[model samples]
Target chain A: MEKEVILQYLPLYREALLLTLRIGWQGVLLALVFGVACTWIRQLKIPVLKSLVTVYIELFRNTPLLVQLFFLYFALPKAGIRMTPELCGSLGLGLLGGAYMAETFRSGLESIAPIQEESALSLGMTSMQALRYVILPQAATYSISGIVANVIFLLKETSVFSVISLMDLMFTAKDLIGMYAKTLECLTLLVVFYLIMLLPVSVFGSWLERRMRRAEFGA
Target chain B: MKKNQLIAAAAAAVLGISLLSTGTVFADEAFRTLDEIKESGTINIGVFSDKSPFGYVDENGEYQGYDVYLAERLGEDLGVEINYVSTEAASRIEYLQTGKVDIILANFTVTEERAEEVDFALPYMNVALGVVSPDDAVVESLDDIGEDDQVIVISGTTAETYLVKNYPDIKLQKYDAYAEAKTALENGNAAAWANDNTEVIAFAIENEGFTVGIPSLGSADTIAPAVTKGNETLLDWLNEEIVALGEEQFFHADYEATLLDTYGADYEDTLVVEGGAVGTVETEAE
Candidate 1:
């Protein structure tokens, strides 16, 4: 309740807020690249590779992010590979997010009618060309919403990076609580920072969904 | 076509059944506190692998520190092979409770609440809550810290609990392990870091431009070896080991061997607890 207390802890919160944004943005970028690549691989219909992708998705998705993070940050070093906390957190989020996103994208690719691909092929388009011009254009609308959703998810998930000692928002909030012994204020600041990052993404997602609906219904 | 679909469906059903059964079988064989450990002939002792002078791995990738030294002694005393289970400050208790480790000797402070979930032996060492802050903007005392300032503390620590109870006005940032807490302090994410005085002092001495402020706080609590609750046999043996070790001032030797560098000339009397100096004797009846 004291103004002085809040005023004193402002720097910690500021730094934490920045860290959250940095990690969230980096995670989202990494997720997009991996997600797209994994989706492409699944589309290829390779005999054993498809099953391998399935296993990767199932393994990462079914397990808790905290456990995966511990494995990356703590266990891996003992096995002789060392990484900074930021690298560990970003890579972990990317790999996990990529699995979930691949499913979203696979569904998006399936939603496009076979007629589109067939038509592109008749026009002398190669498989990659058909995908790039015909399938992807149609799939983008459906995929956009999923991508936005995943970004938000990645943003929230980045909070767990604090477990490995990244100075992200949650870590800063916790530090603030310890320094001032004010749990409520620190938690409030954290919630507010999260909202600040996520609200725009949610709004953009809604706007994109509406635009896709308008395109579908010829509005 | 219909026959092929049927075959596929049957294969899917079999796979699903096997997956479901696998989970149950694995769960049924989950590690038991005593049986699995004894059969393996190696007792896993979880200790902090980053909190120096307690449990930290050195450059050689070997586990070293005061806790490691004590853990080696405990294994020798128990006549069991020792398998060091490196843990962070936050996961030490979880590691013990989940049977990942047979015992935890991670400079874990004994408290009434934690004692309910995990049994504690007689105190082997004593610890008090403390804080470390950057020397340039040092926190001389608890009152000097501002509300907006974040104090970093490792999660699941007595310092975290103490700050939450007594300094309810200050903001706390908690990391799950010492590695994270130290990084946060280094990155200026927190204005100060709080933990056991021994740890804070060690950190301050090792790193440049950090000083221990509020060097001691709350009540001085004993650090003891902990096992999962209901492991009376293991608990009994640990208490006996602590007493037997105390009789010969083994902890003093431990301090001299492992902690003397960190504490140096001035801190020997203040920081070191000679054996038999703290905690109650474990009687057979209770």
Candidate 2:
């Protein structure tokens, strides 16, 4: 590849990297919020809502994320719901991540002893207050490892956004290969880019898992 | 306990019915192409943003090329602001079918298989398939390629399909877009790259030490603007515009101005389409 072409590609790669990070972080935030809400709804033991949550989780979890993204980006607009590619990607990732996160939080909530909620309630605390002060604090500690892992999954999932022309890192890499005709160099750069973004998340997840394990054994 | 189970079954049945009803409602709302363009005021014209001399970005970071020039004219004709929607060779049809773009001006070659899904306007340009290889390589014909030799082609292109069907023995590496396929060729991932003669010639001219070995493989196929099927009003207007432009040889001027650099002094008559006129001379006489 010519030095000039490489130079030209750098900006596109940078933009794509930023897009991936943006999608990943946004999906993580949405997952956290929605996951917590879904977990709490399940905790309420409302039979109808519980079943609905189950269906939602099963549907998204079982299907491939690419199909979900295509549905959001291509199908939704046909129904008069127009969204930009970035929004479609993030929303799709968020919804899919939310389903997985709900299951993660559910497991965390289940691990917490029912006696803790009972004790808080006996002390004249309302259900919401007990959830806020007593239940969530413990659940967050248990779910932190799962959330970190989910973030890694979300980072990889952002690649799918390129199909709708979101200009994420994979898209940029593909573009570079096309424009410069430097297949190996462009692909190597993309692999390095993904590793740089994701390695830290993987390490963090491992560390958090260890800490959680230590906490459990200590108790 | 029995009552609770009965209530749960009723709830599940209700949920199933509601979901089915919502699905039907969505199905009933047919997507209209004209309505979408009018609503947005931005007519999405799918053009290849990477194919040089046809559709590519200039140094000024503007989308300026032959295809872009035509797309702008179409936008003006429609009285809607143009939004250049970049597409790869493979997904251009998907973009049109899914209503992501109103029309595809990408270097789209007309074929019978493609015509079933989308309607093609009169031929704006004529193109033939070609192959490019490194100058050091001795690839005279498709037969010269070894059984192990990998040929690079842009995914979802007629070249890719033709090679696979005609020469199944030759290995092929398909990329999603033109840029990737070219890169694959440059990096020695493939022995040669097959695409339209116009694109291959442009590549050979711009990049040193490359030559188009097979300049014209198939019969001349016309490249044209395409839209989703059943849009009679839009289709009729486009057909009229093509025939009108053909009378003055406007598209030839377009080729001379934008493409003559890549093609040079030779092959102009054989390679370039002079006018936008449609209909065989025999048919016209009848």
Candidate 3:
């Protein structure tokens, strides 16, 4: 209710913001690894492995993040696979993001021509070298926007960590409401905090898109 | 490391992951006793991080509340350090059963079903369900509740359980945290919030344009400390601690220090349970 009280809680808010960012970035990196690896396997037409990748993506994307986080935080611990809240939060976000990111990577990878790979191979390059140098780089340029979008979604999805008691930024706001009973003020602060965090990444995403487009299309 | 050694390590890790499905780390863990905790010099106690006036984090970023105050005194009396583990309402018993916390002081209400799973100490506080709503559309009683009217209840609280069993027709909007439930009530998404009487009373007192219409909905119950089943030594120590604290009128002091800010002087005598008097005064079923 009071501005002074809000000001006093700055340290708590800062700590929470750090946690949210930590989970968000770790999750994004993990999603990138999963998305690119699955896309590569599917493109290579690995028989059983491709189907397994498809299964992983479909299963995670279809289920709710709340249930996934709950299973990791509550149920798995009961089964002796004890994990910290941070691990659960990041892994859940990563798994969900990886599913969506894999789809984006598929579309991007499929758009590049077989000629691009054949041409690189003719120039004394191995098939793996062709993918690393010619094909994957072009695919990345095509899919940077999609990757950025997935990261944005991942940032918001981390709020579900509060349900499993991860002490992220949203959980800190909930605690603020409990202490001060000022839902309006606390929520306003929360909105502003999120905007401050995500808006920059969104801006950087557009910047990267423009740079990549010019690099591809310009002389 | 060499390439062959690296491959061997990775294979080992993968095998370990596969083996976990058949193992249970907690199923064999022995229930912790007071002596073990005293010898270790630190006792893990689970307390809420969101519920107001009971166990909640303050602006100072430190956990300070009624239940937290009790846990601190308990640690001091037991000659050990208190490692406060934050727990949600739904996770309190799970925290005990999994050996995550040695004691749970998260305002656990003593119930017959819960007793089968965990041991309870003497009652420290009394509680009953209460409904709070906007002043203009005050929900005075459940009898007047419309079929379409939505009631907000915290997911794991006794209020949700009571309403579902007794008034199955009334629509309920369940939330996992007090903050979300209050937001639903204030945003007009729900007609009223049903929670513990003390929480409802504190909300109405602290926030404007809200009123506690149905202050006592169900038969009163007592909140007490809980531990894992078969941890009788710890439970007995806790029982003796409650008696000692009562002789010193420690609960009254706790009321003055933590609860008086929200509740004031009125309900002190009834709310503070002395010497863990186990049950409520019997009421004819209504």
Higher-scoring candidate on TM-score, 1 or 2: 1
Residue A44, candidate 3: alpha-carbon lDDT: 80
TM-score per model over all chains:
0.62, 0.55, 0.58
Model 2 CA lDDT for position B190: 67
Provide the lDDT at B264 for model 3.
89
DockQ score of each predicted structure, in the order shown:
0.10, 0.03, 0.04
Q: Tens-digit lDDT track for model 3 on B93-163?
A: 55776688999999887776567667888888888889999999999988778888878877567787788
Candidate of highest lDDT? 3
- Give the distance in Å from residue B123's predicted Cα in candidate 2 to where it truly belongs: 1.0
Docking class of 1: incorrect
lDDT of residue B72 for candidate 2 = 77
How does residue B275 of candidate 1 score in lDDT?
51
Please state the Cα-based DockQ of model 3 relative to the true two-chain complex: 0.04
Which tens-of-lDDT digit does each residue in B1-286 have in candidate 1? 3355446545755565465446434533333445556667889888877878778899999999888888999877767799888876556555655567888888877777676556777776777888899999999788988867878877667787788888888877767777767866876667899889988988899999999877988887777888876777777677777878877878878888898888886766565555535634231212
Model 2 misses residue B125 by how many Å?
1.2
Kindly report which residue pairs in candidate 2 clash with one another. A178-B179, A178-B180, A181-B183
Q: Summarize candidate 2's per-residue lDDT along B1-286 as a digit string, tens digits.
A: 3355446545755565565445434423323456566667788888988888899888987787767777877777778898888998766665665567778899888877677667787767777899999999946699999877878777677787677678878876656667656754665656899888888988998888899999889756778888866666666777787777667776767777777887875755654444455444211110
